[model samples]
Target chain A: MNKELVEKIKNDPNYQELVSKRSSFSIKLTIAMLAVYFAFILTIAFKPALLGTPLSADSVTTVGIPVGIAVIIFAFILTGIYTKRANTEFDDLTNKIKNAIKEH
Target chain B: MNRTFLFLVLGSIAVFASGAIEGEVQKQALNMSAIVMFLIFVSATLGITYWAAKRTKSAKDFYTAGGGITGFQNGMAIAGDYMSAASFLGISGLVYMKGYDGLIYSIGFLVGWPIILFMIAEPLRNLGKYTFADVASYRLRQTPIRTLAASGSIATVVLYLIAQMVGAGKLIELLFGLNYEVAVILVGVLMILYVTFGGMLATTWVQIIKAFLLLSGASFMAIAVMAHYDFSFGALFTHATELKGIAIMSPGGLVSDPISAISLAIALMFGTAGLPHILMRFFTVSDAKEARKSVFYATGFIGYFYILTFIIGFGAIVMVFKNPAYLDVVKNAVDGTSPILGGSNMAAIHLSHAVGGDFFLGFISAVAFATILAVVSGLTLAGASAISHDLYASVIKRGNVDSMKEMRVSKIATVILGIVAIIMGIMFEKQNIAFVVGLAFAIAASANFPILVLSMYWRKLTTRGAVVGGSLGLATAILLVILSPTVWVKILGYKTAIFPYEHPALFSVAVAFIAIWFFSITDKSENAKEEQEAFEAQYIRSQTGIGAEGASH
Candidate 1:
């Protein structure tokens, strides 16, 4: 690690803002990850019997796969939402502070 | 000895010859309509490039469109970039061929948008300038931290570019019977040009334009699906069941094994969130609010796209039943190697042809071609940025720079990276193409996301902790992927799979998280108190930028 980055890290308002932006990700990350996880589980647990397979993409696998896949996908979505929000809010605040410090 | 072998040798020679040839030929597909389309595309591209070139007076504008793009536009651009040839052709084909299984990819992918909206969009937007490296290095040392982020970004971008490049080749071969190498190089050059001249502004506009077309095209087809079935989903479902002979709609159509389903889902959700090209989308927006809006719009648009994909996929099942396109690759294909691409991409193409004819086929094909080009351009640019900007400028130069000089380096980097992609594309022309994307997702989930999340949230996440943890995660994820059965055995023609775990996401994600937490805790820092105070003050300010409700700071 370079000395300058450490110095910048110490002074960076945006970095601090990003660091605090963690609370938002923490709130939604667990549930979104879990929702996808649980959805996958429930889908597998109860592969409910439907009439003739609805015109599928092609093959007739268990209902668990697509739904499970969907759920797993949800995890990333949840995480992305968290990161994007955190970065923005954090940066704006940091920028403001930096501006203030510059004024002083 | 065999006809197949004879054809393969001939095909290889033809590919080699074309790759050597610098001049253009009278490609039949490049007819009058195509000429017009290319004019429009090229004009649009060059126009954006010139504009971007002019506006790129500083490094800031060159890398991030001057951070002026609205979140909604950025979101749309993300959608444009994210909805690649894979999403357009592959998912549709998957849904067309696999039925409910295909929906897994679609829903999983689109679902991540809403997650982006609610969770990470704004914070990420407000947190960084230009690149993700800026975000990570904000709190950490530049050398190791920038190196890790740059490497991770590079890995993601290259893997992603390869995937897009592969898709371009496959689509070209399918649409035009040119050999795969020709297809790859053709698209590769087009992509290089797209990025070389235009930069971010051009790329953004291309994406915005393409996104609207893709969604509208899907929308048109979706309407056709409803009209075909009298707009009754029940009728559509019933018809689908009759065609499938199994319960396609009611849960059982998901997977053969339930656990496989669970694991697969875990891979995709985490995977989507962490993707390099996708995560980079958050950086494009000017503010958090717009980022949020972009995600919401993308989710809504994509939700419709997913639903339409289902309809279209199912339509193929019915269409193929009535008219077997190639009668299942075995009876139709010259060999067993290539997939029967007659499923989703072909279905939509076929539907367009059926409804309109040569004009329509050419239009959709043009759109598909442009779709792949636009995506490959973005992926290549991101990769080049990771290398030039993140690695060279930020890490190598320690974020110290003259504006114009750094931007020039980035341009040179872009050219170099583009050439590399072209070489790789030509070399790996015939391998299973879409799998390139799966590998990309694996890298993203395992390498980038962990460090990004932990750095922002964990106060104890010291520079050493971030550097070590980030590298470990990146190395572990990439190494696992490199050794996985897909690459080691299948692609490399190796005898056996080296690693026990096929999917890196499951293990890599956990390892990265543990490493971050462990390193952050074990080392108590002298700078910790000052860092804490600064971080708290920054947080209060950031909270102000969160929507009005969140402005309660």
Candidate 2:
């Protein structure tokens, strides 16, 4: 470990913010995905008849089709959502903290 | 990148056109177009290996490709590494056989990508140098932790390698009319060549190429399938229901009960995060940002690929179900129902023929073989690294060995693994490849995932806790799997299973977590205290990416 960088990162407020914000944000997103995934899995476990219901009165497609697709598409959307925040918010704080340490 | 895509597109079109002409005649058992297409792919990959071998000089280059790969490239390689024969042939076949149940598997496989992205990817890139053990052993005693982690990795990799090798053998024999032993040897030798000579670079490139071919081939099949019904998914679904039944639109008999479904879900979700070969891909990138970006790209590509497979599966239900041309007439004699030429695994292949003809079938068969080769190479490299880097260099020599010597040992380990895989693959050819892969995932999720997550996030985790808990998890998973229905009754010919469930993750993971909590908190040893204090350094490093090895550049 580099003693200087470790100490600097430990003492910086921006570093603290980066850690907290990123952790909370990731945790939130994780919970969201898990909620959807577990809901689907539990439905499959307990009442699969719910998934078996038709999407429309006349349609042959089941509700599970779009629901499953939504789960997958939601994964892509969440990744994009995280990357959008990370590349902007998190990367900015990291660069600021690194620069602050360098100047000192 | 453009050049690679262009070559793939042109090559596929040529195969498609040639296959259309070949499809006009009665279907031959041995399709020459598939053989020629496979030869082209093999020669192309071998050329890449020759080029990569020249640049692979040191241990760093051998293990992590000199950390030169960008995010997009590593993402492609990761997708390539992940989309195994099971995902391609197995998933589509499931969909072809049992309609809505297949999507459940696709969802289970895809959901893990997002979890990995949210939690594991960036920290993993920051903490580890070469292997997942590097991260797990950061605050613990290196030798013991490395030994446990390496054993877990080797077990997972060998099981996965055998499954992939057997799949390749069966697929090749079906497609090219070759012997299973010959096919297994071909796959095994090719994997050893990629790992021993070109190392990670060759394996990554091979995976990327195979990913491209599979995506394109599957995409074409989906498009062709949609075109058959005027490109309407609604029409596709309607036709599928009309052909099979109304119930085909929903979940079927795959998930027996709540316990097994949830247990299988747990294994699939966490297992991806713990797989050694997949985690090792992060180190090939330059930084945590690249690792993060790689996951984003991987999730997008993998999600899209799963959707295409859904379309291909439903397409097969409509197209390949009753078609006599693709059916085995003799099997129909026993059942009075039309079955596909091979088992359900041939659904995607037969669908390709129904849509594009023999050339397209040839192209897909080649891509399937390529998928097996790419996955096996990644598994073999991870296993070799466990033996050489973790066991030989770190444990035996205490990190005092020459880098060149370590690389040499890795190459030798690769050869030995290749031979072992060939033998095990042949022995397990008659066994259920899917069941074997499930055991690998269960061990990984139960043993590796619990320890890895606790080490990264928990401050109280001691060296003893990790070792004891990890071993318990590993042992419990293996024991429970043996006693479970899949192995006990099916494999060992028993009347009833000691453990009634099919999956062991629900029990094994809980045991690991409980043991970790108990051992880590109760132990008051000086070593435990030191490990607890060192967690601050490890946490800061994992979070801020400071003092991370190879991060200076």
Candidate 3:
């Protein structure tokens, strides 16, 4: 509720670091996931045959199966990447900022 | 291992709810095993309700389970809240009928989890209380914003609830041989009982149980399908293609259009984040970290479940499609193909029979039925909370009411909602309500998602901007859907649709974002300036969880 505290936290080094680091990290991961998903969608629309074709001549499996699985796997991996960083790096910075505000 | 075993038990209860063992098809005499299975589910959940009633002593417990839920529990509860009968029966039915196109729904639904994890969950957990409108109204005019948000929540919940209820009625008619009215009333009574007495604690446990049942049952079906193919994806595809042709493995006709596909993709992705019921789950956890972790576990569970559905579809393709035992003996004269035992929606049910026989068939059917019950309860709770908490307490009383009185109002609202769901379910029994869910999503994405995102990140957002822009988004989404092919041509029997596309999110969502941005920047009201100034305090609390509401425990 304090105007001075608001100004102080906004200018605090720890707060700025947390915001910048977390926002950029989240934004990059979100864009990556969106690209992969949209690429899959667009390919279905424009280049249908590419996903329809079999992976190899002998196998009955199409290229789309692995790609679909890959998308699911990719989601988990991205989530892991974010969670790992958030739990370790981001939480540490957030705690430091909280403590500093409390002391002040 | 313990968790997996728990899911198996939970999943088996769902099958019991479906009532499949006795009569998947043929109006044969009722089966006792299925009845017993359903009774077990009934008794167990009723016991949970009784236990939850003992602890639900205040408004907080009624709405958020006192924020005492753990990350894993909340994750499974979310899955239960989300994975409706539509996901289990509808996607499998789509896969059974259309093949590879079914996975599009799978992927579209799964992608929203990560977005929520990154942006909405933490800030929402910190800034809001009980409902999403709490956060959206943080620095704005509380009355108008809360009113608009409550309206949006009710619209989405009611439409979605009707779809589920109607689907339940039809499914029960087939699986249990019950009259349509009776089935709808049963669902209504049970949902009211869960929310009115047990509240969020009961609702959370019910969802957790339902999610487990769904995951384990789907897993069992998928495993059985794989075992038949010697655990080889290639073998399953080979067998499936033999029945449906090579297109079964391709994107096929369901998504050939670029515009429609992208529109659908936008609706599913953004809509999940904006859903009132889904957003409400964030408040059940103790902190932002648990909220984040809940999404992580949800994504993992939901992703794994979808992969199983792919197999289940292919399994049905090989086992149930064109198979004499699971089909009508009389063939269609022109098509020369036998109708499936109960219809395409029962494809997963028949596949259970093919692999696990009578008992498993009954089990899967009950799980599908239980899926509907759990989903309906969640939607009811959300709608009730919107009415009592946002509308009555914040707007009418201006936050001056007692907690006990508010809780009483919420229970009354739940009863009203349950009756409304039943009535709407019966009325829309013959209507094509499948597209209604899509319209709900479009409204949520267009109206709620844009306003929510802007309110959090954009410091310049004004009360006028959020209300007007959100109302426009809401209105446009509804209007466009009415003019679109699904409603205009198909439902109204028009020769041609004014709006060519089936989805409205692609256009409406953009309109909302633009409107909110343009209006906020142009506004010169003194209150607007004050609202903008207050954003700094909100931003600090949202980011750092400082001075945010704490868990009572």
Candidate 4:
């Protein structure tokens, strides 16, 4: 890209907003994922029995099964949430930044 | 096209001749249905390759399928690449043996997708052209950065290829009653043809088809198992617990300590992001939006596939365990405990026959072999790209090479990689290759991921810092794995390992980041300053997709 166009986009508020909003959003989502995963990993590491406990007194199903499946589902859901926001909100700001540079 | 057909015929004939010679010694009945299904899959993929070869006219098409794949198709392809035979048979086999412990791997592998989607996918699509080295070397010195990235990529690819090839040989031997050497040669030749002739387009389609078949077959197995239990997991678990005790419902011996667990978790998560084949899929899509959508779909398919594998594992425990028909009676008599035919890794395969009968078993076997072929093809293509694109065209020719020559170089690299994979697969046939995959994940997490992420986000990442830090991470990962228990004690017959843990990502990744930070900040060179100044433009393009490759199209 040309230096002038890059400078214009860099100084544009839309670009700034897009960058900040998207980065923070991604960082937040990433932390959420890491927190969830690490929590499970720590549980597997430290207290295996906690996840080993059955769902009910008479149940053969353990707590870990649901928790593990939930983690997998949680990952998919987070990706969905991010894709939705990125394709709509983030793309809008990007297009606005592009338009501003073109107008200049 | 005629040469391609001739090559395929010769390869199949060689495989059959070897299989026949080995069959006499083994005295194993050939699985005709499995052989037929495998032949069908091979012919179909070869057909796709012929079509793809006609369309693969440029270096662009050779690498990223001319950036024409849709989000959903790319998503399936990514899932195909991720859900290899290792994950399918390996993870399910773990579950069948250890129960809940297998889910740990499934979860570790699945969790990487969200992080990739949030952090790497869009920037990778915007900044890269063919390989991830494109993105990593965006503002850094091309030669050093490309060399480092390509080394890491090739290392990761070859290690992963060896594991997949070994697993394929073993699985095919048990599933199709084929000879191990024949299976390896078949995989090697087919993979070389797909990649050299068809390139990314053929490889992607093969993965998509294999992913579909694998998902459908596993889904059928899981559903059949559930149906036997009235669609209640509680019933399946109840029966499994009754047969194998309640320990099957809980964690066994997969992860014994905290450090190992965390280290392994780190490797599995970040390793997915650093994988050249998986990362290369981002460029297969048209734009950032498609990239984002692809990850969404990929995560869903992969996550769901893991769930199915988990179910299949539990189902095997319920249905295949202690079943006299599936058990090797002579081995069980000697061992005093019933062992399933072909080891625990064949748990899901045996479960297919138990639940869905011989025809389904044949289908699953074909799908399993197809999965191996697709994964190895992708790995060879990625390795070839690392050699041809990063090392040859960029580093050697200094970006002056023509596209046609680059394509030829890649095809040559593909054939060499295929041969190496076959040789290594045969050599490691009797060795414990489970750690090889773990080592691949560690190298990727520690080496490729840190440099790629730092180059994009860290403003001070110079060529010196990247090369030094990346090479250190790569070396550390390899060295530590050698010293770790899996290699040192298990493979090398050492008394005790110097390193207590089996995984080195937690330490090696930290070392890489710290070294990169230290070296980058300490370097006050004019080149370093220029790189830092150039980051703004790179970041702008990364975020906004301005001047991104294939963006105009």
Q: Which ten residues in a row have the lowest lDDT in candidate 2 chain B?
A: B15-24
Between the candidate structures 3 and 4, which one is better when assessed by DockQ? 4
lDDT of 4 by residue, B1-553 (tens): 0111111111111221111111112224688888899999999999999999999999999999999899999999999988877678777877887788778767877888998988899899999999999999999999989999999999999888887777677677777778889989999999999999999999999999999999899888888888898999898898888888888777666665677777777887888899998999898889999999999999999999999999999998888889887887777889967877766767888898898787888898899889888888988999999999999999999999999999999999999999999999899777665467677878889999999998889898988888888988988999998897667886799999898776788999998998888889998999999999999999999999988877223
Residue pairs in steric clash, candidate 4?
none
| Candidate 2: segments with Cα more than 4 A from true spot | A2-7, B1-28, B432-434, B551-553
lDDT of 3 by residue, B418-508 (tens): 9999999888777666467777888899998988888888999999999989999999999998887667876799999898877888899
DockQ metric, candidate 1? 0.15
Question: What DockQ does each prediction reach against the true complex?
Answer: 0.15, 0.74, 0.72, 0.89
Write one digit per residue (lDDT tens) for candidate 1, span B1-553. Answer: 0112111111111221112111122123434554466457667766777776776676666667766777668767877887775566656665655455556546556555554455455556666666767667765677787788878778777767766665566566666556677877777776666676667777888888888878877777667777887887656655766876543444323443444344344556666666666666666666665676677666655666666767776765655444544344553456533333343345566655544556656666777777877787777777767776778877778768787878788788888887887777776565544345556666677667777766555666777677777777777877876686656775677888686334566677778788877876776677545454355434443344421111100
At residue B170, what lDDT does model 1 achieve? 59
Assess candidate 1 and give its lDDT. 0.61
* lDDT tens per residue, model 2, B338-377: 8777777678989999998988988998998898899899
Query: What is the Cα root-mean-square deviation between model 4 and the actual structure?
Result: 7.2
lDDT of 1 by residue, A9-84 (tens): 4466565555455554555565655675455444433443422232355544444444544553454455445546
DockQ of 2: 0.74
* lDDT winner: 4
Q: Model 1: which docking level applies? A: incorrect
Give one clash count per candidate, in the order shown: 63, 1, 12, 0
